[model samples]
Target: MVDGGGAIQRTTAQFEGPRERLLCLGPAALRTDELLACIMQSGNGKQSVYEISTKLLQYVGGVYALADIDVAELLSVPGIGRAKALQIAAAVELGRRIVHKPSDQRLQIRTADDAATYVMDRMRYLKKEHFVTLLLDTKHRLIGEDTSSIGSLDASIVHPREVFRFAIRRSASAILCVHNHPSGDPSPSSEDIAVTRRLEEAGRVLGIEVLDHIVIGDGRYVSLRAAGYMDN
Candidate 1:
């Protein structure tokens, strides 16, 4: 896979009675999958619309990865037909248009604060944890950002190989790990510190620097490096 095969896998909270809740509680109550379910409208004979949406998300990896998949690739999934796949591809393109405007030509990550501010809005609002990487070029300019995982923070979930594989492919000189706290606290847990140390060591071996591990919370953030965990 030319995509480097490292997945992003970011998802919103799973929907519980999505369409029903959508009527009673409004769109804010719908998960990302449920919102997509609304777009898909219905599924193939076997799977329910929600199940189809979930399977499509898994096949493409996630919202971030969806932008990379063409309609042909989407048709490979069991429930996604040609028309449905194109519908999804078009929706993904529309979303990519909205949230991922082109980066400024002079984009830079000069400080951990700069890194946190770059991703905080997206991270903070997420209902689950999202482990993301800011891929930076030699001049510390932003090349791309990859979400490595989305869920609770832990070492097992944060695979160094998967994390660095894409960074290496991006020709990134350094990476900044950013993840959110759904509980609204920006403080680092012991697990957070451990993952930072582990990934920092892994980055050293791979010849790519791990600049900082930032924890995003409601309107605030933490830089492990500034807290004496790692250095810039």
Candidate 2:
């Protein structure tokens, strides 16, 4: 790599690939297409990296659509093959891990609001009801969080077994049951209270305490324990 004066213009000697732009100007400087090109490396040789990446984006609609796509769908792009499709899928998964990875400090859920705060960032805007459980240690520190079921329009549809499987396996001392209402109403339905009571009884048998059942809505929540439903 040399310059017009026969001197070493090593940094700028050759073409400006996505990697080089990223190095010189940082990630924020790169456009969406440039970032995709970086992941894609180079084209199938018939087209440039930018062109192929743009075409791929067009085929998939957008980067947002990439989240739900699998290997086979990634291969639908004209110039994309197994290697390219796999690289994209792997990158998406890696990004997802980064986004959802918990904080270094162990999460503690003392109240329903605390538990809601821990999950609201991810669960807030969901299009369907998601029943989730937070497994807690003896100290009430969060050990794990799991989605027990999705599209649960009614609480009765969410069985106690599905909610407690991991808590039993992990030997969790207590658990918090939380679910989002897509309708954005945090008010607890009669069925919600019934399910919570049922789960509390089931937990009593298993030696796991059902601490609270929190129903999430649009920036609001209701705690069954707080409402005197769980005290009985």
Best-fitting candidate, measured by TM-score? 2
The best candidate by lDDT is 2
What tens-digit string does per-residue lDDT give for candidate 1 at 114-207? 8887776566656567788889888898898888886643322678887898998889998888988877799999888988988988988889
Task: Give the clash count for each candidate.
Answer: 0, 0
Give TM per candidate: 0.59, 0.67
Model 2 stretches astray by more than 4 angstroms:
1-17, 43-85, 99-105, 125-129, 151-157, 181-194, 215-232
Name the weakest run of 10 consecutive residues (lDDT summed) in model 2. Answer: 7-16
Ten-residue region with minimum lDDT total, candidate 1: 7-16
Instruction: State the TM-score for model 1.
Output: 0.59
The lDDT for every candidate, in the order shown, is 0.79, 0.83
C-alpha RMSD of candidate 1: 13.8
